[model samples]
Target: MIKPSSPTPDHLRELKFSCLDQFIGPFHYTNLIFFYQADAAAADDDENGYKSQALKQSLSEILTVFYPLAGQVVLEGNSSINCNDNGVAFVEAKVLDGRQLSDMIEEPNLEELKHFLPTQHFVVEDNIVLLLQVSFFDCGGIAVGFSFLHKVGDGKSMGEFMTAWANANKYKCNKCKCRCDDQFMNNFNLASLFPPVEFLRTTSLPSTTNLSEKFVTKRLILDRKKLTDLKEAIVSAPGSQLKDPTRVEAASAFIWKHYIIDSAAQKRRQIKLQPNVDQVEVVVENAFMAQHTVDARTRMNPPETNVFGNCFLIAATEIVNYNDQQQEMHHLAYLLRKAIKKIDGDYIKQVQIEGERYFTNLFQRLDPVLKGKLGLCSFSSWCRLPFYEVDYGWGKPLWVCTTPIPLKNLVVFISTPSGDGIEAWINMLEDDMKIIRIE
Candidate 1:
C-alpha cells in the first residue's frame, strides 16, 4: 500500500459524487495498460528495485493532490469518498517468459493480455478506489497496469490521474519538487454543480434485463488510408449532409453499416428456420442502435476542462428504416453527426435544470434495448485522449491498451503509436461476432 506523503486535511474529508457519477454502479473500474521499453543508458543490476522504489515514492507524493484516490468510498446514504488518507494498493511483478514487449504488440491477444492487469474485466466488488501494477519483462521492458474505480470519474478523470503520476515519476530522481506536485490544485466542482440524484440508479430500476451470454473481445487496426477513403467516399456523394466527417465518425459509420447488413441477414435466416413465423409481422426495422460516448467537458458553455468526475453523454442514434439505409454509409454517418450535435450546451443546461426528466427520457430510450427489441452498440473513443503523454523518466510508452470490458456490443477506439491508424477493440456475443467477422 502507498499512502499519501502528506495527510488529507480534515476539512476536505468527504468528496461527494456528481449526479453523473451516481449513474455508474459501484466497484466497476476503468483499466488500461501502458508498456514502456527499458532505458539502455540507465542499465543496472538494481533497475527493477530502483524503479519500484521511485514509483512508490512519487505515487505517495502525487496522492496528496488526488486525495480521494487514497481514501475509501462511503456508501451509506449519498455515496461519497472518505478522504482519511488510507492510501491505495500497489503491486510489483516480473515476467519470466523471456519474451520482449515487441513480441506481443503487433496484434495483441486480448485473452492472454489480461495477465498483465490485476483483473480480467475491472470488476472486484471492492471499495478500493485505485490500484497500480508495474510488471517488468525478462527483456527489461515494463508494463504498467492502472485500475481506477468508475464511480469516482470517467475516462477523462483517469487520463488526468495517469498523466499526473507520469509527471511525478519523471522528476522523481531530480531535485525539482514542483514537478512532482501537480499545478491544478483546485478541488473538483462537479459535486456542487450536479448533486447526486438517487432515483437515477435506485433499486426500483434495477438492471434485471441483463442477458447472461458469452461475449468475446477482438481488436482490429484501421489504417489511415481506409479512413481517408471512407471519409472521401461519404463527402464526395452529391447532396451529402455531412461536413467532412472525422476519422472516428467515418470509421464508426462503416462498422455500423456492416453490422446492420449482417444482423438483418441473420434475422432472415432465423425467420426462415421457424416454420410458423409470420413474415409480414417480423419486419426488422431499425433493429440496431448506434450510440457514441461524448465527453461533455468541452461541450459545456463554460468548459470544465480540469474537473474530475463522470461527465460523458451517450448520444444514441436510431435508424428508422435499417433495410433501406443498411448500405447507405453516407446517410448513416450524417445521422450520427446529427445525433451527436444535439447534445450541446442547451441540452446539458436542460439536464442540470430537470434531473428526473432527463433520466426519464434516458430510460425510455433504453426500454427497447432492455426488452430485447433493439440491439445496443455503443462506441467509446480514446483516439485524442492523453495516453501518448505518459513518460515515467524512462520514456513514453511503446504501446497503450485498454483491457476488455465485460459489456457486450461495445466498441472502443484507440489511436496507434503513429496516430494515423485506429485500433477498434470490439466486444460482442460469440455468435454475433461470427456474423460481423465475415470479410
Candidate 2:
C-alpha cells in the first residue's frame, strides 16, 4: 500500500512520464462536484474567517492527497494535461450572489469557459480542465461544481479521490506529505496481448454536423418496488430464465429498447426529400457497455497486480440497424442480454486485442462513417457502484449533475441515488427527446 509523505515544490515535475498516457481512453475521465451550505453571515477574506479557514484547510488536504499521487495522477493523464500542456488551473473559491448563481444555472457561461480553455487533442495536445465553482444560494447553500475531463478517469475513481481529499481536509492534516510508489511508475508491455494487424479493419465513422438546441436534465427515480417488478417481468418473459439476470443487464435492456423506440419515432417526424421515402432511418447506438468488475488477475496473481490506477475496460455494444426491421421491446432486450453474456473470459481477451489493433493503425485505416456515428448514444449503469460512501466530512452530496459537452449525440448516466432504487440522467437533442413516449 502507498503511504503519504512531505510535500515538495518539484513534486509534479518528478511524476511526469510518458508510459502512463497509453492506458487512458478518450472517455475514461471523471469529475466530482461537492455542494456545501455556508453560514450566511460568514465574511469573505483571505486571513481569518470560518469559510476562509475551511477553504484553506481543504486546499491543504487536496494538495496532500493529490501530491503523492501527482505523478500517478498526471502520468495517469486526466487533470495533468490541464496543468502541464494547457494553462488550466484549479478554480478558487469566492462569494457569489445567490440570485446570480441561480441565473447562471439557467444560462451557463459555456462559451466563455470554452474560450478560457479550449479543448485540445489528446495525442498531440493535452487539454483537460478541473474547475471548482462555489456559488451561494438564496437558501444559504453553496453550489460546488467540479468539472473534469472525461478522458482521465471514470466515475468510480473520481468518487474515490473526492472522498479522500475531503477526509484529509476535514481532519486538518498539518504535516501532510507526498510519497511516490515505484509500482505506479513501472512500465508494463501491453502490446503483445492486444490484437494483431491481420484481423483489423477501418471505416469512416459518423460525424455530428448539427447539435440540439435548448438542453435540459431530467432525473427518473426507480424505487425498490418498481425495480423488483421490472426484474420479475423480465425473468418471467420468455428466454429470460438465465438463473440470475443481473439488474444491470435488465435495466440496460429496458433503457436500450426505450432509446430505439424514441429514435425511430423522431426520424418519422423529420422531412425526407427522397421520393417514396416511406421509412425513416434512425439508429440507436451506445458509447460502450462498461462492465466494471475487479480484475480477476489482481485477485489470482499477486505480483502482476498494478492497482495504482484504474483497471477496467469498456466493451462497446449497439443495435446497428434499428430502422431495418420492426422488433418487439422484449426481443431487443433479449438480444442485448445475450450480447452482454458473450463478454465473458475469452471475449475480454479479444476486446483487448481488437482495441490495440485499432489504435496501432488508427490513422491509416480510419473509416469516415463509423467515426461520425460513434457516441450517438451512451449508456452507463453504475448500479452496484459505491459512490455514496464518498463522504469527506459533511457527508455525501445531496445531488450531482453534469454539464453538456458538445458533440456527444446522447448521454446516459445511471447511478443509485441516495435512498432510492436507481437514477437515470439522460441528455439528448431537445427535438429528439420530444418524441420519446415513456409508459
Indicate which candidate wins on lDDT.
1
**Candidate 1 local lDDT, 348-376, one digit each (tens):** 88877776677777778878777667776
Candidate achieving the largest TM-score: 1
Name model 2 segments beyond 4 Å from true: 1-31, 37-52, 61-129, 137-140, 174-216, 241-243, 268-274, 278-311, 318-327, 341-355, 358-376, 407-409, 414-416
**Per-residue lDDT of model 2, residues 1-439, tens digit only:** 1112335345343432111224343432243344443434443343224543464455544544344332233433222332222222344444434343334434544332221222222121233334344444544445555554443434544554555555555565433321212322342222233322332222222233233345544445566676677677776766554445555555555665666666655454552444465432223232222122233223222233433233344333443455423234345455555655555566555545466453444333223224543223445655544555554455565554444443333344445445446665555556556665443
Q: Candidate 2, residue 212: CA error in Å?
A: 8.5
RMSD of 2: 7.3
Error of 2 at 397 (Å): 2.5
After the best TM-score superposition of candidate 1, give how far the Cα of residue 404 lies from its true spot, in angstroms. Answer: 1.7
In model 2, the Cα lDDT at residue 11 comes to 30
- Cand. 2 Cα-lDDT: 0.42
Off by over 4 Å in 1: 40-45, 76-78, 173-182, 201-212, 278-281, 284-286
Clashes in each model (backbone N, CA, C under 3 Å)? 0, 27
The models' CA-based lDDT, in order, is 0.78, 0.42
